[model samples]
Target: MKSTVEHLSPTRVRINVEVPFDELKPDFDRAYKKIAQQVRIPGFRPGKAPARILEARIGRGPVLDEVVNNAIPAKYQEAVVSSEDVKPISQPDIEVTEIADGERLAFTAEVDVRPEIELPELEGLAVEVDETEVTEEQVTEQLDQLRARFGTLSGVERAAQTGDFVQIDLSAAVDGKEIEEATTTGFSYEVGQGGLIDGIDEALEGMSADEEKTFTSKLVAGEYAERDAEITVKVTAVKERHLPDADDEFAQLASEFDTLEELQENLRERLGQSKRMEQATQARDRLLDKLVEGAEVPLPESVVQGEVDNRLHDAVHAFDHDEERFAEFLAAQDKTREQFDTESREEAEKAVRYRLVLDALADREEISVNDQELTERILYQAQQYGMAPEQFVQQIQQAGQIPAIYQDVRRSKALINAVRSVSVTLPGGEAVDLSDLLGPEDDAEADEAPDTVEGEVTGESAESTESAESGADTADSTEGTAADAKA
Candidate 1:
């Protein structure tokens, strides 16, 4: 077998492969044998059919077709391997060129090659982040979160004030024409929560049980059917939050902490830890932004288009399948999908570029994840998902997500390490501890790298291909921790 490659672009190549007659003979013979078994000859038994006799009876076209079909893929692989070009991550476009009796098998394959990036200087990237300390107010906020968790709802006979819980049946109308209405059997609302409209909350104020109130409010256009909606709400009940005393007895009932002081101290420590983590995240992101902005590279149009199409597909599915949910998401963001894509394309590009930059940094610095670290991270992630570590590892493999997680961990470590290498001058002129700035115990984990190439990944293309959902879990865990700390 012989192979030759032609460079089509910086990220693509075309390979032409030819299998000699000697190499093609084995497949041809195998094909003939298979055909013989399937066809019958007049003078021979079914199992004892001769290739020549079968070929004579069935003709050469079928046998040759079978031989070509069987040989193309194998030959193409060999051709790719034998050539001086790197094989593709995706399936190659294969085209058979020649196949004749006692002749060589020939084919061509075109595929995208991994780009060879010339990494820019990365040692002095600038990052601007909020390095504010965890204040008493922040601590109090954390404590409030905990209190909210243990708070109880109680019936009230007074007017519904801001922060008061109210039970009501809500209906919406346009020009006195009822559009929607529903009676919630037992509902609770925190008046200042802004969950219901401003007008509804205002009307509910000073309204007690059995007191009916009606008001009109404007609905944000597009998300809801009406441009501006007129809603009529009837306050059926009034309730207020009853929080337990923050003392030793409450502490004992809520958690392992036996005293309120102990709980507060624990909450303070947790809040401090949380703030440090946030600061570290902010610093890392700022540094990444600077690096991406500084570095210059020609992004493959194919890669960007692929990413955009995939994102668009997900967006379309979200909108079409769950319009209400999608609308709610848009409302929170204060923008529609079209508006978001236009405004956020630079962010998307920055994300792509930063991954590439970090990967290059990892390679330059020789960063890696050892087996033990991989196991520990995987186990930790499994525990987070509420699964046994071993079972979760197996599930990750089955779902083909282990590599993605591994790559993410590697890139994160690389980014942390890069930030650690820099000298940070804070706005207040205080020297920042790199280790603390990167996150707790990040230094120890930064040294670990994957042991095998099976899950080995470099370059941002594959990494970005992963689901953009890790941050959601991080946010949930942070919120939960905050709430637990307050308790």
Candidate 2:
């Protein structure tokens, strides 16, 4: 067997492979066995017929076809392994060139490959991030949140206000027909959360106990989604949260702190730490933007198209692949299919470029994802999807998505490495020390920093806490922050 590679472009290659007849004996045997099991012979038992006898019965062309079909994939893999530099990122476009009887088989495969990237110097890159400033007001807000957690609700005799909690019965009718899924009784909602139906807050604000109001709002979900519905909300009870006074007793009740002053100080320190973490997140995102913007990465068209197709498939899947419903959804968003296509293409290209940049950086830095890191990422993802780790692992393995997860973890680490190497400064040009947020290794060489820190400080650590606490979308957060820096 022999193989040769042709560089079609910076990010693609064509591999031509030839396998002599002697090398395909195993493939031929397997093909014969498979064919024999499907066909019956007059004298031989099932799957017990000799290869020559089977070939005589099925003809040489069918046997050869079976052998070629079974042999190509394995041979292609061998060809890839033999060529040390040919790393394909997409499925190959294979064409069998020749299959001479009793001679040799030849084929060519064209595929997208990782491009050679000329990376910029990591240490010399400089980026600016917001300074970590935990204001007194922020500390107060945190304390207020703590107090709210321990607050009690008492019935009120007045109209509902913005901060009031209310118990109400809701019913909706679209085109004079009641929507079953949109009706609920004895529902508790905060006055200004705005999550239930649109215009519910306005209707509730001025209503007192036992008062009913009807308002028209668009149903955002269920069968009547995007349709205007006449909603009748009847206020059963009005209540307001009565927070405890910020005193030593209240502090003792709310936390382990013996004094309110100590609780305030602790809250301030925690807020400072959170702000520093935010600074680190901003630095990570900005550094990634700088690296991607400064580098010249040739995107693979096939990979980008694959990503776009996946996104489109997911989008249409939510509407059960009904094209008309999808079109209606776009219309509701005030967007056309053309606009969605353009935006999806742009997003796909950006995502591909990001992955490419990080992969190149990972190679340059010799970054590797170990078993522990991979497991940790898998567990985290399982938690995100509300599945057990074992179940999640099984699902991903069956779906062949483990490699994608590994790649995401690798890219995340690569971006973190770039963040640590880059110089991060405040608006006033003062260099900010992110050692506390980025872990001690990030500042190990600094004269004033400690020798070591426990734990890794990557974007995952910074974003994971925020995502878990606020249920923030990690992709949207990163994209928004990166776009802000770019702008």
Candidate 3:
């Protein structure tokens, strides 16, 4: 067997392979055995017929076809493995070029390959992050949050207000016909949370206990979705949260701290830590933007198209593949199919570019994910999806997505390395020290460090409170590639 590679482009290649007949004996044997089991012979038991007898019955063409089909994939894999520099990122388009009776077989495969990238100096990269500042008001807000957590609800003899919680009965009717799914009694809701049907807050405000008010709002879900319905809400009880006084007794009750001043100081310290984490997050994102801007990456068209197809398929799947309903959804968003396609293409291209850049960086830096790091990421993702780790692992394995997870973890480590190397400064030109927040770069500690999604450092202790909300912009701005790719 022999193989040769032709460079089709910076990000693609064509491999031509030739396998002599002697090398395909095993493949031929397997093909014959497989076909024998499918075809019946007059004198031989099932799967026990001689190859020549089967060939005589079914013809040599069918046998050769089966052999070629079975041989191509394994040969292609061998050719790929033999070529040290050919890193295919997409499935190959294969064509059998020639077959000479039993002498030799030849084929060619064209595929998207990982491109060669010229990496910028990691240490030379510079970025600016927001300076960490914990104001007195921020500390007070944190303290107030703690106080509210221990607060008791007191029944108020007045109208419902923004901070008040109310017990109410809600019933909705569309065209004077009641919708059972939309009707509930004794529902407890905060006055201004706005999650319960739209315009509920307006109807609840200024309504005293035992007061009933009817208002019309659009039902966003259930059978009455997008239809205007008359909702009648009867407030049975109105209660305001009464926070304990901020003194020694309150401090002792709320925390391990025995004095109010100590509690306030602790709150301030926590707030400061949060701000610092925010600063680190901002730095990480800015550093990534800088790195991507500095590097010139060639995106593989096939990979980008594959990603776009996956996204488009997922979108249409939500409407059960009904194009008309999808079009309606687009129209509701004030967008056309053309516009959506255009945006999806752009996003796909950007995502591919981002992945290619970080992948090349990982290769150049020799960044690798070990078993423990991979397992930790898998565990974290399982928790995110509310699945048991074993179940999640089984599902991922069945889907052949273990490699994708490994790639995500590798890319995350690469990006973290990049972040650590970059020069991060504050707006006032002061060099910010993130050593305390990011921790040391020892392998044992890095393996234990919380994994980042995409290119952002996330789930650090300081950022835990705001992790769900704060990283959203970074994730969205990057088009979810950071998290998806473990960037």
Candidate 4:
């Protein structure tokens, strides 16, 4: 067997391969066996017919078709593995060129290959991040939240208003006909919470006990979704929450702290830690932006288009691929289909670029994921999707998505390594040290970005949030390539 490569672009190549008939012995044996099992030959047991006999009965065309189909994939993989220059990032476009019967077989595979990227110097790459500070307002907000949890409700002798709890009866009618699904009696609701309907807040406010108000609101679900319905609400009672005073006594009851001042300080410390994590995340993002900007990554049109198609497929899948329903969804969000397509294309380009950049970094650094690291990442993502680790493993394995997730974890470790080498500072030029939060390079890693479909740029790629939400992106089935679903 022999192979040659033709450079189609900076990101794609065409491989020409030729195999002498002798190399295809294993493929022929398998193909003949498979075919024989499916067809009956008189006087021969099932699957026991010889290749020559099967060919005589079934004709050469069928046998050759089976052999060619089985051999191409293996030969293509062989050709790629033997070539030092080829690193395919996308599936190959295969075309069988010739079949000199009893002599040789030839074919060509055109695929998207990773470009030769001269990455920018990553050592001590400087980036600016925000200063970590916990404001008094933030502390106060935390204290108030704690207070609300321990608060008690008391019946109020006044009209329902914002923050007041109301016991009310609600019923709605579309075109004057009753909607049973939209009707409830003695439902407890907090005024101004505003999840029930659009106009409920305004209607509930200023209504005293035993008072009723009729208004119209658009129904959001059920049989009358998006339709305006006449709604009637009768207030049975109004109650207001009485929160404990923010004093030493309240501090003692709410937390282990003995004083309000102590409680406030604790909140401030926790917030500061949270802010430091934010700074680490921000630094990672900014450094990625810096590196990608400095690197020369020519986009692969085929890979970009594939990413775009996947995004569009997911976007419409929620509506069961019904264009009309999808349009309605877009309309609700004030986005047109053209705008969505344009944005998707733009995102696809960024995602592909990010993947290429991180891949290059991983290679340069010789980044490799151990089984333990891969398992940890898998477990984290499984929790993110609310599935047990075993279940998630089974799903990805069934879908042949292990490579996609493995790549994601590798990319994450690459980004973390980059973060450690880069310099981070505050807006005022003061150096910000994030070693504790980001962990040491030897012990640190995350799996949440392009995190692609890339579980991609905006969500997965370049977005490494190690502290707050660092679980990387969701893994889709690996793209089709040299091996189907293993690209």
Candidate 5:
């Protein structure tokens, strides 16, 4: 067997391969065995029929076809791995060029590949993030939130005011025709919370039980959408929330703490930790932007198109793939079809460039994802999707997405490494340190590299082919910690 590569472009290549007939012994045997089981010979039972006899009965064409089909994939993989410089990122387009009965087999495969990238010096990377500090007002707001959780609502025979809860019946009419979808009864709402509809809060204000007010507002949906409609809200009951006094007894009931001061201090510390994680997130994003913008990356058109198509597919699916509905959505967003296309293309190009830069950085730093790190990532993802770890693992395995997940983890570590190398500062020029948020850097993790392309440490994809989404979990955990602090 022999192979040679031809450079089609910086991001693609074509490989030509040829194999002698003697090299196909194993493939031929497997093909013959498989075919013999499917076809019954005169004297032989099941797969016991000899290859030559089977070939004679079925003719040489079918056997040769089977052999070629089975051999192409394995041989193509052989050709690719043999070439050290050829790192394919996409599936190959394979074409069999020749099939001389006994002489040799020849074929060609075209694929997209990663181009050599020149990385910027990591030490020179710098970014600025907001200073993180917990304010007294923020702590007080959190404390009030805790108090509100333990508050009780009591019935009151008075006009509803701000912060009061009310149960009401609502009816809407457009041009003297009642809108059934917009009418409801026994709906409970909080005054001043808003968001139910335009002009609702004002209509409900200063109204007592058994009192009704009719107000005109514009509807956003249904046959009378965007048209003026009259809404009548009848207040069925009025109630106000009453809170327990902020005292030592209240603190003990709300949490393990026995004093109000200790609770406030705990809330302040929680808020401070949340602020630090926010700083870490800001630094990671700004640093990534700085690094990617400074580097020159050659984008693959196929990869970019794949990403753009994925986005478009998702966008259209939301509107049931109806052209008019999609148009309305774009119009609502104040975007034209041409503008959407251009933006999607631009976003896809940026995503491809980001992944390429991070992959190069990972290569330069000899980054590898340890089992512990990978398991932690899986657990985090499982929690996010609200599935048990084993269930999530099974789903991903059936879909053959484990490699994609592995690539994402690898890219995240690469981005984190870049964040570690860069400088972060506040607006006032004070240096910001986020080691406490990002966790400590391990020397062995930094030094280790996957010894093989498909090794357990590396997982798969010797060279990653896509962008990563990470660092958002930093904010999520911070929020969880803040909630825990409240408890």
Candidate 6:
């Protein structure tokens, strides 16, 4: 067998492979064996039929066809490997130019390759991170929220008021035609929560028990629906929130604290932790922006195409396999598949570029993940799926997602380390501790970020965070790419 490769782009290649008849003999033999067991000859049993007899009975064409089918994929892959390029991001477009049952077989595969990157300056990048400090007002606000969580609902004899809970069976109609039906015999709502229709709270504002009234409101526009429908709703019940007595008993019942003051302090600590996390996230993003801005690597087109395919696949799945629905979806987005691909092409390229940067940084730093960290990540993931830890690990391994998960963990650590290596300045010109900016310590104990949605960016700094949120705007921004969902 002989092979040759031609560069089509910085990230694409075309490979031509030629195989002589001698090399095709193994596949030919296997195909003949498979065919001999499936057919019978007049003088011989099915499994006992000779290749020559079978050839005369069924023609050599079918056998040759089978041989080509079984042989091409393996040989093509071997040729590709021999070229020493990274694995193809997608299946290659293959074409056979010559094929003979006992003669030569020739084919060509066109595919994308991982791009070689030249990473930009990674150290001493300029960035600013927000400093997180717990305040008395923040503490008090959190305590109030905790109290609200413990508040009880009680039926009200008088007209309902704001901050009250209401339970009602709601129905709607339009132009004398019943348009919507939503019945919850015990449906509860906080008057100003806007959990229901926009005018619902106003409609219930002055209503007493057993008092019924119908009101009209506009339906909120969505991705597909037009915005002209008016809805009618009838109220059935209203109730007020009754605050629990903020005493020692309440504190003990609500938490592990023995007194109200202790619970308030604990609440303050928790809120501080949350605020710290938000601040950390903002700083991390800012640092990433600086890193990406400084990066000088050329993105691999294969990786970018892979990303585009992923985005496209997600778009396709959202339509639920209904062609009309898919078309309507694209229409609503003002995009055709080709157009969307064209638009996301740059984003896809950036995504792949950032990923390559992160991977390379991980390798350069010799960053390693511990078993405990892996176990923790896996366990947290299991909890999200509501499965046992061991069970989730087994399922992940069985599903072949373990390597992906490991890579995710490694990349996360690498990004953190990358950020850690940088020094950040505050708006007031004070140097911020990179450790404080990376994350809070309790992140290990708290629930991990939801595996489904990407980790949301929280908090904002006076500078850099804005651009970071906009995505990597600078050469130094090294924000990792968002993960792809399972296929």
Better of 1 and 6 by TM-score: 6
Alpha-carbon deviation at 145 in model 5, angstroms: 1.6
The TM-scores, one per candidate, come to 0.70, 0.89, 0.89, 0.87, 0.81, 0.74
Candidate 3 lDDT over 135-162, as tens digits, reads 8998899889999899899898999999
lDDT score for candidate 2 against the true structure: 0.74
Count residue pairs with overlapping backbones in model 1. Answer: 9
Candidate 1 lDDT, 1-487, residue by residue in tens: 8888888876667889888778877887888777767777778766577677777788888987898888877776666556533534334668888875677778888765445556646666555445656677776776677777899988877888887888877766666566644324456677878755757667877788877766656554333432345666667888888877777988887779989878878888887666555566566656666665666644444444444555555665745556666666676668887786764455444444554565556667776766666676676556556888778778766755655565555666676676777656576666566573344444454423222111112223322324322211111111000000000
Cα RMSD to native, each candidate? 8.4, 6.6, 5.7, 5.3, 8.2, 7.4
Q: Output the TM-score of candidate 5.
A: 0.81
Clashes of 6: 19
**Model 6: per-residue lDDT, tens digit, 309-353?**
666666566655556766666665677867876777766656555
State in Å the error of residue 184, model 6: 2.7
On a 0 to 1 TM-score scale, where does candidate 2 land against the true structure?
Answer: 0.89
* lDDT of candidates 1 onward, in order: 0.60, 0.74, 0.76, 0.76, 0.72, 0.62
Clashes of each: 9, 0, 3, 17, 0, 19
